[model samples]
Target: MGEENLLPNKQIVLKNYLQGCPKETDFELRTTKVSTEIPHGSKGVLLKNLYLACDPYICHLMRPRGLSILSSHGFIVPGSVVRGYGVAKVIKSGYEELKEGEYVWGITSWEDFSWNFYPQQLLIKINITHDVPLSYYAGILGMSGLAAYVGWNEICCPKQGEIVYVSSGAGGVGHLVGQFAKMMGCYVVGSASTNQKVDLLKTELGFDDAFNYKQGDLRSKLNKYFPKGIDIYFDNVGGEMLDEVMLKMNINGRIAASGMISQYNLKEPQGIHNLFSLIEKRLSVRGFMVLDYKEKYPEYAEWAVKKLQEKKLVYVEDVITGLENVVSAFVGIYHGLNIGKRIVVVAEE
Candidate 1:
């Protein structure tokens, strides 16, 4: 190499196993040196991370916490860098398919510079031909988009004029799920934690109905909105909301079991009392993990991008500037502070 490629990389390290809900203090920003060199005979890539996608699931890896949100995954190493989905630029790579300067989005560390040693599949490169912002790959064009697609279309196949309800209606995945359901000719309703989000759902996102779930009794609200039972339920906050929806589901209804953010922070996750309704209603409650659908990612991305381009679909994002704000941006999701996808812009590529 003609020049030395040492650079200071600022990263967020877990201070310790998070005891409860995560706080800014739970993570500490530390700087490390990165050499923009793909080690001899090693298959790894050096990345200049531009954006970090923050979501409720990232909070589950903290060990000082509750029920296993994702089974068998070990806790994050306290003094080590934590990883999540994000957008990055390849600074150097030994991998054949990934050339330097290519943009990619996948599981990346909470750092300004990340050395990804995983397979090309985990560090999948983005298709840069789209005219959208590069940061879009960190969110609507990333895993969140796939999750919304699989849960909304793949799992809960909606029929024209069927009723669909989504919890956490203003959330990263929930927001898009509602839109996709509506596009398919389904009459969709969403539940948000605040009035502002509820309004956006009805006005901007084109949901047929939206209500502040915190403002009124859920059961009564469902009765008011759906005189008949719901035909499809896209569950994002799956605790009390799931229980209520169970009672208001039509026979043979479909419930797409997405993330249960309401239960992620609890040591003991809440149980649904009306599971018998699942039996009586003969409902099909299905859950999906986005990683399992990677093979179809290209197809889904193309279709979703076309939807956005043609103005058939719309999205919202809560972008916080600076890598230093990564921890706070993540914790904000559980509080329902973000209206849509929560993203942390770490640096410019």
Candidate 2:
């Protein structure tokens, strides 16, 4: 095929819907020719992916049929390509709003090349000059970052001196939540699975304090960390951690339910047996999806980007190179194998 007539190709496909934890073998890297020409009157652009986000939400898509899907979030159909947020550059654009060579972050199919797509449907044009790395737009400055902003600002609504605890504190969403709480002048405590993660949370990410949840005495540890009782709990791990946090929640406390990674792998999610505490403590627990807060993206992005420039924001990511390793990188997230945002670099900028 000639340059103007060449087909866009080179993609990763899901071998099948995963039944248990997704493994690297579930995806097959292959090439397929796709038309480079934008269909007549179509408002879309073609892009080459630079960075692809490997989020826990992708794990929800891997579940076998008949198992409870995570919140009706769509999964990768068998033989179809996996999809997620990514940073890409416009290679060809029939759409006036997107120009060639513009950097953007948005929904993208997992591939080296994407055919014509409505980039604006889920995409945001990005500036590459911000102090943060461009890949931050895929995580901290993008979806996962927005997840933290909404969960903290709209849902948790912290105040100065409030005690806030975040589970999985060193992760894509968790790390930001703890830091945002600190920015709001709250007492932030995070629980990580490892000592190194705990250190990153406390020292690098600016958590007021942190502990390794994989170690001893969760309830007692939280109690020891927050002697005054927690005013807000950002529940990411769920299950027993949520239960344990309830034991330490103060009256009128709030819980923002973001994720439940612990239960994602189990046939039956652990039940929370502490509802009685909610009544006695007058606590409120709410679950939120970032899509519900899209109107705030511009405001959040502006503020977050400012923080990044001021050195008040920290972005961390675990990156694995090559499209071939995308499957392994995604699966690693489930085992808490990555720090900060998990990204698969499929191609160079």
Best by TM-score: 1
TM-score of 1: 0.95
For residues 138-189, could you state the per-residue lDDT of candidate 2 as single tens digits? 8988889999999999899788989899998999999999889888899899
Show the lowest summed lDDT stretch of 10 residues, model 1: 65-74
Model 1, 1-349: lDDT tens digits are 4346788889899988876678888889998788887788989988889999986787778775544544433467689887888999998888888988898898888999988887465777887887878998888889899999887778997888899998888888988999998888899999898999999999999999999888878889989988888999998888998998999999999998987888777777798999999899999999888878888789988998899899898879888999888888888877888889989999876
In model 1, which regions exceed 4 Å deviation?
Answer: 1-3, 64-74
Q: Which residue pairs come into collision in candidate 2?
A: none
Report, for every candidate in turn, its global Cα lDDT versus the true structure. 0.86, 0.85
User: Measured by TM-score, how close is model 2 to the native structure?
Assistant: 0.93
Off by over 4 Å in 2: 1-4, 64-73, 128-131
Highest lDDT against the true fold, candidate: 1
What's the lDDT for candidate 1?
0.86
Number of backbone collisions per candidate, in order? 0, 0
